[model samples]
Target chain A: MTFEKWMRESLDRVETALEHFLPGTDIAPAKLHDAMRYAALGGGKRVRPLLCHAAGELTGASAHAVETASAALEMIHVYSLVHDDMPAMDDDALRRGKPTVHVQYDEATALLVGDALQSQAFIALTTAGNGLNDAQQAALVRELALASGSIGMAGGQAIDLESVGRKLSRPELETMHRKKTGALLRASVRMGALAGATPDAAALKALDDYSAAVGLAFQVVDDILDVIADSATLGKTAGKDAKDDKPTYVSIIGLDASRELAAQLSRDAHAALEPFGARAQRLAELADLVVNRVH
Target chain B: MTFEKWMRESLDRVETALEHFLPGTDIAPAKLHDAMRYAALGGGKRVRPLLCHAAGELTGASAHAVETASAALEMIHVYSLVHDDMPAMDDDALRRGKPTVHVQYDEATALLVGDALQSQAFIALTTAGNGLNDAQQAALVRELALASGSIGMAGGQAIDLESVGRKLSRPELETMHRKKTGALLRASVRMGALAGATPDAAALKALDDYSAAVGLAFQVVDDILDVIADSATLGKTAGKDAKDDKPTYVSIIGLDASRELAAQLSRDAHAALEPFGARAQRLAELADLVVNRVH
Candidate 1:
């Protein structure tokens, strides 16, 4: 299949799996469940889950395990976005081309929604009936928790907020990206591998290396797009990062150099998958797609 | 031993165990570790952990398993308190007789601290040396996630916030309390049993019944203390719940009726423990302590 077709298929599978896993109670507080669905189903590329599936496939992991892991990762991504768009955070009015959760609902609702999503991610991983033994399931839960919490996404966000308007060196920027984005991405691969129970030490290390390069490349491309893409195309304010004076790869390394770095990182990411041979084509394509996409 | 003496001894053991579990880590941005420890060690009654220990003992679960389960439960409790104290949540300036986390640090720091505490809780459980198989570990993680997330404590808080100033029926109050305070308390017992690898369905149900009754009784006493205790003695703002116009057992039912209800629930809790015979004295004492405490 073409890359776009493959991506869409994978995302559709993820969404269906996620929806299936949600709490299906007929309780009076239907609104909470509604809010969760709204935030999760709101359109965006299922990059994290796709990455999980791709990495799993490359390592001979089962599709069912990959789907569950992908759904969990996507839930975390959705929760973060909902929280990030709150008035106290980015205060963005739009996300994924529509009103953000807080704008669509009240701040309290949005906050609760985010909290629920965060918790639900773990619940999904814990409850997934993929025939995983307790130890492997516990490992997946640990990976998700570490990836989504402080010293990971939350820590990275704190640094990002603190570093706003300040110039950061390459090492500092990389550190921020590693926590904010790389941690979850790396966990996605690790979770998929764990779910499949195929993540031997060497495979795990290679996936981590692949995840780090792709994660950084993902951020660099994002920064480059903020400069090159328009608000209409990006679905949110494009140049808001620059307007807020947040440091970016394009700012530190110039647009051309940033592009070069992203390309090099993409190549590194693909090379990290060398052991998987032909099974890694999709992941390689995903790396290329990360750097080359417009939004 | 008298209830107070037993509690004091149990608390001491829990504190010592906590310190041993949370050995100093060298993860940089050392503040990450500091924030985590600050929140975790910044004292509370350790009621949840004690419950886990008591339940574990009743089930003949290992002390090591009990300690791990207790530590994880305490971490979740601490994380909830930290997040709930944020300006956007309860806006509290004091907790456990000390400056609330956000007040001592910055809001961002407190947020990250809470996030880290939560992540560390699951990490602790997953990495626990309890010798349980993977399935048991997964069950523990799942239980914690359910108790802490939406449809649990966070959801309870949201509902409580919305219900403030509004009169609620008895069932409504029960539902709120079940989610807000009871879920984790029940989970504490459940986790203890799971950690013990004692999968006796009947005993689990009995403990659940015991936990539910004791959990409500605990809230009743808390509500009563809000009315009768002073801030200094309670180590928190006294009568804040009533001041906020929040519904409570004492508020909805007269004080006399509330006390009667608490007594009845305490009796029910003890009756539920009858199934475990003499092995459950600690848990029975805990239920008594819940209702009899002055603060």
Candidate 2:
């Protein structure tokens, strides 16, 4: 299938799976449920889900398994965004061109919403009859938990909080972004691979290398877009990183260098997937998409 | 062994397990890790862990498995306390006789601390070589996730938030508490059972019944203590429910009736374990302790 067609079909499957798994607004605690759906559904480019599904393609993972895993990944990504946008965190109001959970609802509800989404994501992973065996389910849950916890995404956020107004070296900035955003992105690919048959160690390493490059490239492109793209185009408050005085690739290495670095990383991502050849076409396409997307 | 001795030994084991599972404070993002340890390690009654270990005794669950599960349960309980005490939530400043996470750290850090602890809890469950097979691990993860998510503890919290000033009926109050605190408390018992050999359906049902009674009794006693105890005695802001105008068993049914109800629930809890005969001795002791504790 063409990349765009494949992307459209995968995004549709992810949306349906998320809707099926998430509690309805009509349920008890309706407001919290409403906020969860509002935050998760109809938002962002679903990049993580795309990555998960693309990676799943390389292993011939069942579409049902991939869909559920994709939903879980998207939920985790959305939960992070929800928490990040809270008044206590980034204090942003706009996300995906819409009001953030805290702004749309109350702060207390948003907090609960984020917490609930995190739980729901695990629920999606551990839900029975999702086509994954017990070992796969357990491994996937562990992978997600490790990526989401203190040493990973949340730890990165803590570092980000401390790094504000500090002139971080390129290494420090990379470390922060790698943990903050890169960890979950990496987990997305790894989880997709695990959801199917176990690949050879070399193939696993290749996917890891591919994911690492794509993950970093995704962040580099994000930094580039934060500088040059309008808030309208980005669907969030553009230039807030500079305003917040946080370190970024653009700040550390200049815009041109950051762009060059993203290109290099993108090439590296594609190169890492060469072992799988045609089987990794979707992953290669996703690498290009992550590097080249405006938002 | 005497209940007190068993309890003390169990508490020590849980502490050791929690310390082992938690990230070291000296690690990078030291502040977040430090706060996580601070919130989770010292203090609190460790009621959930006690219940888990007590339940584990019934099915001869391995000490290692029960210890890890206890830690996971305590982590979830502590995470709820951290979030519940946040300014955006209950706005409390105290927990376990110390400043709440938000007070000791910042709101953002506290939020992340709670979030990270939750992830860490799942990590404890999914960690390999913890004496559980893959199916057991997956089952346990699902139980934890369901209890923690929107339809469980978080859902209960949302209801509590909405019903702050409103007078809820007894059933309504039960529904809220069941989800809020009851879900995780109940999950603790269920997890301990699952961590070991699978109990027969009848035994599982009995355990469920016992957990339901104990869970409600625990909350009823909490409400009673909030009314009758002081902050110093309770290790938290006592009477805050009344101060916040949130309806509780005491406010709705009167303190005397609430006490009677707790006693009855305690009796019901003990009765539920009658099927297990003397094997449920620890659970029986725990039921009494929960109903009779001062704090």
Q: Each model's DockQ? A: 0.61, 0.91
Give the fraction of native contacts in model 2.
Answer: 0.87
lDDT by residue for model 1 (A23-74), tens = 6546535677777788888478788998888877766677777777888889
Q: What TM-score does prediction 1 earn?
A: 0.95
RMSD of each: 2.0, 0.8
Query: What do the candidate models score in CA lDDT, each in turn?
Result: 0.82, 0.92
Return the TM-score for each candidate structure. 0.95, 0.99
Residue B65 Cα positional deviation in candidate 2, in Å, after optimal superposition: 0.6
Task: Show where candidate 1 strays beyond 4 Å.
Answer: B1-9, B20-26, B128-131
Model 1: docking quality category: medium
